[model samples]
Target: MCRTTVANPMMNEPWQRLPALSLKQLQYFVTLAQLRHFTDTASRLAISQPALSSALRQIETVLGVSWSTVPLRRSL
Candidate 1:
């Protein structure tokens, strides 16, 4: 029996060995992106404002990218 393995650069990377990100972090990131307001997103998510900010910062640090510089969609 032969098992052909697919290669994923992200999966092979050293950083990829790290644990998965929390669902809460992803939720905060998405909410912040859609609302563009920390306070509003925090309230909507029922999490504290500082917690929302920390979640975003932690993700950005782990991913080595800034969400502020990333444009997900065109705004009016």
Candidate 2:
């Protein structure tokens, strides 16, 4: 006999409250947030550094806050 366990839908509910982030923006933010280096973040995002910068700028404009002002904890 085989058994399967499904994650409780409620356990994943927190994700529902998050604003939708485009794949490009999400990748860019994740890279930038992890590295805190624009150049590196751009490289990791597979876009021109300028493009990456512009994307982040657009995100800031849309969200009305600079990413620098946001709190992010470093992963140990």
Candidate 3:
């Protein structure tokens, strides 16, 4: 006979475990989320598009979620 143990099913306290983010990454995410345009977001951030893209990727990795994965509703 084989024995198995069930793991705990509890929500993680993200605030306690998550790493701190740099100001640049936070700015990049906010701009990208608002514009939904990489180029424009980069321009607004005064950085190259590739750099902005890299920053967004880093932030996504930290947050464990893609910016596009979150549903956003626009108001008229």
Candidate 4:
């Protein structure tokens, strides 16, 4: 008999090109991605809209990618 454990993919940094990302920032990113609504995500995260935006910005800074704009909505 053998026992095996699967490692967490996110915890493994296969590449060292980008800076390390914090779990909080990733949470903000993932939450916003899932909800696609800043107000709702902010409410779910129990943080102000501005705080959510800030966390997202921090994530972008760490990854050096423009995940999305901070406006949170399109003026269509």
lDDT tens digits by residue: candidate 4, 4-37: 9997777666664457778887788888877879
State each candidate's clash count: 0, 0, 0, 0
Error of 1 at 24 (Å): 1.0
Residue pairs of candidate 2 with colliding backbone atoms: none
The segments of candidate 4 whose C-alpha lies over 4 angstroms from its true place after superposition are: 1-18, 69-76
1-71: candidate 1 lDDT, tens digit per residue:
99999887677887668756788877877787888777889899998888777888899887788977887
Model 1 error, position 31 (Å): 0.9
Query: Which tens-of-lDDT digit does each residue in 1-76 have in candidate 3?
Result: 9989886555366665667788877777777778877888889888998887788788888888886877544657
Model 1 residue pairs with clashes: none
How would you encode candidate 2's per-residue C-alpha lDDT over 21-46 as one tens digit per residue?
79878778877888878887777767
For this target, which candidate reaches the highest lDDT against the unseen true structure? 1
List ranges where model 1 is wrong by over 4 Å. Answer: 1-19, 71-76
Q: How close is candidate 2 to the true structure, as a TM-score?
A: 0.60
Model 1 misses residue 62 by how many Å? Answer: 1.4
**Candidate 1 to truth, TM:** 0.59
Lowest lDDT block of 10, candidate 2: 67-76
> What is candidate 4's CA lDDT for residue 5?
90
TM-score: which is higher, 2 or 3?
3
Top candidate, metric TM-score: 4
**Candidate 3 TM-score over all chains jointly:** 0.62
